[model samples]
Target chain A: MTTDALALPMAVPAAGLPARVRIHEVGARDGLQNEKATVPTEVKAEFVRRLADAGLTTIEATSFVRPEWVPQLADAERLYPLVAGLPVALPVLVPNERGLDRALRLGARRVAVFASATESFAKANLNRTVDEALAMFEPVVARAKAEGVHVRGYLSMCFGDPWEGPVPLPRVVRVCRALLDQGCDELSLGDTIGVATPGHVTALLAALEEAGVPVSALGVHFHDTYGQALANTLAALQHGVTTVDASAGGLGGCPYAKSATGNLATEDLVWMLRGLGIDTGVDLGRLVATSVWMAERLGRPSPSRTVRALAPTVASPASHKEQ
Target chain B: MTTDALALPMAVPAAGLPARVRIHEVGARDGLQNEKATVPTEVKAEFVRRLADAGLTTIEATSFVRPEWVPQLADAERLYPLVAGLPVALPVLVPNERGLDRALRLGARRVAVFASATESFAKANLNRTVDEALAMFEPVVARAKAEGVHVRGYLSMCFGDPWEGPVPLPRVVRVCRALLDQGCDELSLGDTIGVATPGHVTALLAALEEAGVPVSALGVHFHDTYGQALANTLAALQHGVTTVDASAGGLGGCPYAKSATGNLATEDLVWMLRGLGIDTGVDLGRLVATSVWMAERLGRPSPSRTVRALAPTVASPASHKEQ
Candidate 1:
């Protein structure tokens, strides 16, 4: 385009700022946990290693839930040993003190406490009220913090709840405040059912700010069930939330969710960031190929549009649009 | 959200402004033209009537193309008569002078002309060069004008060509200008392969503006291939473009363009508009239900996320946080 064209009223800036955001790879834990087929522990470990090699700084290795609840991730013990000693930080999900005990015994340096913002969701998912769940996390956070392990708290269904209706912003703020007060170094607000619009993201973040939660203590996790995940993430990034949770190959769909939609694909996120001149250390081609490999292993096509669009065909890539 | 939290930045003004925009529903024409199964003419006529009932003033009815090429829409003759005398402005696509002759004989009051920006695509689809295709439209546009009929020009492959690589913005602007100069009342820019990004949309519209084409004279047509169609359309709306072209159920995908994805679903576009408080005069739930019907007829679920999420579940319109 000519310089005259770029000078239009809404001219796009070069956006030279580094996309220094950290992507916490969640495919290993959140992704495989929902799969019907159990991925081998060695395969899960290799997935983590590949993700780290692709320049991801953090990886949610595996959840320590009971085997009866999540048979796919039942071999977390075996998987944790193989992924140990990686340079990247590994955080595992702990539903309660028992799950925390498993991670702590396994030498976990970081652990995440999971809770939902809605009473119905919390009751259904964790089988406890919000207060009771927060109360249970008190011991888990204290133990992990005393052991010098960072504790990250997750508030799921913060935007919209399935059993109930629209979650009140005050309720979300209270949950965020509770998580912060309970010693979570950072809080990742999850649109667990992927019903969030950009406006919802902005409104929730604004309420959090008003509640005196520092922006630095926040991350955003989005599902792509409604196809607003990327747009919602952009809203969060603009609000200065630096950490994002994404599943590789967009592998995971929420077990509680009815739709077959995929999570936000890491390759697609990296592609958008790179286009904006954001510096995500993750290599796009390698990540795309790795995601394709994982999809092959799961006997499914990759859920990522970017991966599918970028994969080679009989026609050359150059034949496709450069944009 | 609190008052302070509610007041966020604005790129586009709320739709309550004095300016009234028009939405041209292309579901019946551009949408079904590419369907695998031939839609009965009665179904096509009923779909047009439903769209008109949904407050869509401009509904594209059918294309006067050869039955051998587009078998799905081969019964345009039968369908056009069914929608005749409707209060809505129903336009039909005319491929050439021969097609225009058929439309004129059928008393088509409003007609649309088509041209491609890329030579390869022009040759592949229309069996002509880019210049030849535009030249072919010159007579069609003239005949429509002489017959006191309104003419709209469709410039396909504006952002990227499926056969050739990147289509330069200058080339797209030139084609758009030529079509406008050919006595067409409006210009519709199509991302036929769905390769457009917001940056591309911004840059191209800016180029058109710099070329002295009134932004209000342009409409946007996007496909959801990269999942950026809505975002790209939002970027266009930020400019003064008042019209957008969309297919119901995300119905249109180019069969000639291998791996090309679905068009921007009318339901999805309506959802975004309603979220932004823009008045498209289209009923969200009814549009979604109609799209679901279309999808069922095709024996395929919709390619639109909004239709899939809203229909058969969301009983009421959710409140918009932005509003």
Candidate 2:
């Protein structure tokens, strides 16, 4: 919002875009869990702290999946208390009652339940059928609500699954309704394979709205795997859906970090939103600095185009002659 | 377009989206020219041949710039005739009458003149001021028209120049009008530094339209350095512009390829257009293959997210054990 000379080129906001969007930062949980290296518990906590200091109001702290399933996040128990005092809503991923119990013990305020719209992705990710996974989350959601916890349902593969291609909108709507009916306060429709386009997003949001789910209760989770994440997010925003999930620096969570272009980079989204004159309450400069810090720790450049653009001196070590 | 299961997970065409878009393939000219390695003359023609085979109707063959200025595209005279027989419009870049003379002798049906919109870029790239560059191309465009060769004008830095913060929309409109008035059939607006967002694209397109430059005469050239190319392109598409300039596999020509993340990848654009159910005559599979082929020659992976997504096995050699 500062008229700083280096700020992104700002323009008048187009009609239909949200005046302000809430970015759900998933760097700690989704970004790191997939990373090849196990970030120290202290580093993970610092990552959360930096994200909050950068003006992020909602950050997914860590996932409570079994250590056997996600060894990288095995230190979630250690990660939780470290970030508990940050002045932000730190959410954690909880797949079942056992994971919910872990989050409850950590005094977590927000928890997200992960589900899939396709049978193949369900079986592949959760080792269960789609219906079985939904059934499994019922008890967890109930207990979380009973304990006054806010629940966010994540519908992975809501757009397409690697194994299933394009998921039927009706199936996604059905799963979404079930999650909302089961006490989830909101749903994050995920394009797990990064194959979604803006038209598909508009059509799907319309279907979800027609099926009686308010647009207010929906957020979008996209992967930049196909590079349409920002465009897809724009379509969703134009549909009046305000909350979007992004990972800082487009992190793939790979410790080796050769191919780390998974989640939409938060800096990219903020750049677009800020340029369109929309408010996100997030500071682009601080976010880029955070990614730069994390990339150093990971021993690789941040794959985020926005982060790299803002901090170009770090992306390439070689020099270019300036005219 | 086929109901074949692999047709991009397309939704019904949304309102305001063009049913069909003409993709101007720049892989051979814009892509390879900035590449660090000087691709063989035969391979340059082959790249254009492949792009046309992939259903690209407009492929810019090569630039007729001085060999000393662009050694990589030094074979433009050698490259033209090889692709002249193709059932596509082969446009070559002609900076002035000398370059136009090379195209004329080679029987080029279509040629493009490169101009800079900002004074700084004009002086740096064309070694002339903005008006001086426009004046320099006036006769080149006129002579090309007299010879019955269609001329396209490229106005670089239409949005922002690296040395200049944001080029005024009126300035872009004036340059665009001058080109169109100078007998140019179409003008492609180039965000040479890739700093534009959808909002800026929208505003600029609106100003251009208001200045009486028909939307049909406008094409957008974007760089993904900040990862906003597709989004900016979408804004132009929604404004009813039909031509889009893209390089296969996101190739950045090395004349300054080190800074060339400014062009949108053809595959990434196709994925969005196809998913939007917008008919682009280009084939996604064939385009990805072309990029993959070029990447091998370049000894690097394609920077395209769509190509990387389609050819994931090579991109992520690290295995993810399937259930």
Fnat of each prediction?
Answer: 0.07, 0.53
lDDT of each: 0.77, 0.83
**Reference-based TM-score of each model:** 0.86, 0.93
The list of candidate 2 runs beyond 4 A from truth reads A1-7, A253-261, A313-323, B1-7, B253-259, B312-323
Instruction: Single out the weakest 10-residue window by summed lDDT for candidate 2 chain B.
Output: B314-323
- What lDDT tens digits, residue by residue, belong to model 2 across residues B160-275? 76666778888888989999999999999998777788888888999988899988988899988788899888888888989999989998732322344637999999989888
Cα lDDT for residue A27, candidate 2 = 87
**lDDT tens digits, residues B260-299, model 1?**
6778888766655654556678776667667776666678
Give the runs in model 1 whose Cα sits over 4 Å from its true position: A1-18, A53-55, A311-323, B1-22, B53-55, B146-148, B310-323
Please provide TM-scores computed only on chain A for all of the candidate models, following their numbering.
Answer: 0.91, 0.93
Chain A of model 1 scored by TM-score: 0.91
